[model samples]
Target: MYYGKIIGGVLGLLVLGPIGLILGLIVGHLFDNGLMQTLKFASPQNIARIKQSFFETTFLLSGYLAKADGHISRQEVDHTEAVIAQMGLNAEQRKRAIELFKRGSAADFQPEPAISAFMEICRGQRQLCQTLLFFLISLALADHKIEAAERQALQRLATGLGFNAAQLEQMLRMAQAQGHFHGSSGFEAQPGTRLEDAYTALGVDPDVDDKTLKRAYRKLMSENHPDKLIARGVPEDMIKLATERSQEIQAAYEMIKKSRE
Candidate 1:
């Protein structure tokens, strides 16, 4: 009888190899629930920690970016609040975000722990990480300007999230090409004529004179320069976009110069 049963089991395995494997897996999982849980889902404590860390890191970084241009304008604060509201964070999360923002605005904003935690969270959920970055980009441009230091900091965060240079550059280009200049709206101007629009994209006045234009261009270039952007966490792919924007600005300046002449 034993021999017969063994023979029958071998026959079943041969007849249903995949099904047998699946069943074996299910039985094994049942027997090793602890291992399975550890491998698949984060512990409750870890989940809470991750959520807290994400909120803190995001708020801190956003605050840092807001203050990068010497002062955090009311517009920036309002924009950040809007972002916070949109995130649909719970009371605890909202409170944590505020605390982080306060810490981030301090004279010494050390981003290492936040960055590390962000990376860990991103490793587990890439989509969430991307979403967080998208929010940061929006925050950086909230005041219609991207400061050099702010851009640098953003790029650094992107890189720390494991985005390669090429990937970062691509994302930046997509962001620019999408004409996110005035938030998430589409392109609002045509080519060439977009010179003034480009200035607007950089949050500058279209009628700026040569001296001011040059100064603004220099300031923007200093921040968005490919190398500096790369150093700051801009993905390599998005660096090209920043380069293109810089070129557009130069072109606009030249056009304005010719018009003045």
Candidate 2:
């Protein structure tokens, strides 16, 4: 008799082993031909693969975005290096990231395949997708303003990844206010931060109620949580961005609370 759960071929021996078990995490499959799906689990190898894919895509996309404006300015190059330093990537990883960036910056570089592959391997995780987009946007705005070419490139990339115009605009505003990408939606505890920028970060209007405000803050925090991303196969080394972002979000919320009181 075929059991409902995963079972061996009569003698109760499993052939697929870890591969079958890990498939459940990425694909959530079920066999119809009297065979059971592999026991549900996410393998360590799968986690590593997911992280690597994210790392590669982010590096390449960063280059592509930078070059969208006819030439990458010296300031933009410095900004890229600053971000790399902020990520705290190791020597070998940094070298590989640089290589990927160069390839994407080529005059005839193609972005569709890279975007498609990124979406596929990401398993449709919206937060990861948002995070990746967030990083690219931050890089684009690093020179204090986004040129026409940069905006068009971002819009195309955003649309290709299933995000609409509204979401992209909202993200750009929040990323600019926060000055970094960690998934949070608020500004840092910097001096003279305008209340309007705080509202923009949390993506709420001035007329929003306290209840709605808090909810938005909580949602952003959860989505941008470093531990949450790490648990879902994001590279451990990249957690620093989220960590710093958490601090900024907290600061923004605190500032909002003070104004309300």
Candidate 3:
């Protein structure tokens, strides 16, 4: 349930007018019941409408994410098409995905209601949610660089998913370490020796004034709070990673504070 998909679906319904609205309700109803019971609860017409809305949302979100880094690269477009292919969507669904992408691209990709809908879907579908998250992280890292704005966007999405600070931090760390292998090679050096690197990873500067340092610390703490982590579906095993990162950040800030005194 990517936020882009949810947004695209809703927008598609709006464009399709009354006919689309009716279809959405019908499909939604069918989805509420098991597939075996789908026939009992919804008509073919309603099913078609639901399918339309679903694909529309998918395309919209994809387009939005593509535009997130300023311009849509050829790589991003290919990545999106790949996802659509994997979906095994029929002709109509594919058309809908394309249409949604057009609309999302036209709209300059502001993310809001789309993100909310995505979070709701995540709450209901754990495995799908995780898969979607993995895809998003991959997309974010696709260019071999994670932009600050992209990271902010992810943090906002994580919050919408009810992720506590701890959970968000863990996700951020994992996402940041995406291409790197585990073990010492991939491991960030110990904080003392690699203090500068640690600060950079945390998006902070050691030379900042105390007030700025405190502000950055608070911002990081709020974003990575444990409560937020649990909400975002972070496994218990990974929570420690976040806790440890936070401790390191706190320790660094303290060291800076002590030196300034």
Give the best candidate by lDDT: 2
* Per-residue lDDT of model 3, residues 213-242, tens digit only: 778778766655666654444433334445
lDDT of all the models against the reference?
0.61, 0.76, 0.55
**Model number with the top TM-score:** 2
Each prediction's TM-score versus the true structure: 0.51, 0.81, 0.43
- Tens-place lDDT per residue, model 1, 102-207, is 7887768866667786776535355446545755776776666677777777777787666766666555643453352222332233343445445554445767
TM-score of 1: 0.51
Worst 10 residues of 1 by lDDT: 180-189
Clashes of 3: 15
lDDT of 2 by residue, 99-209 (tens): 999988999988889989888776767888887888788689778899999999999889877899999999998877765322334444566568776787778887899
The TM-score-based order of candidates, best leading, equals 2, 1, 3
Which prediction has more favorable lDDT, 1 or 3?
Answer: 1
Where in model 3 is the C-alpha error above 4 Å?
A: 1-56, 118-127, 164-166, 172-261
Candidate 2 stretches greater than 4 Å from native: 1-41, 180-188
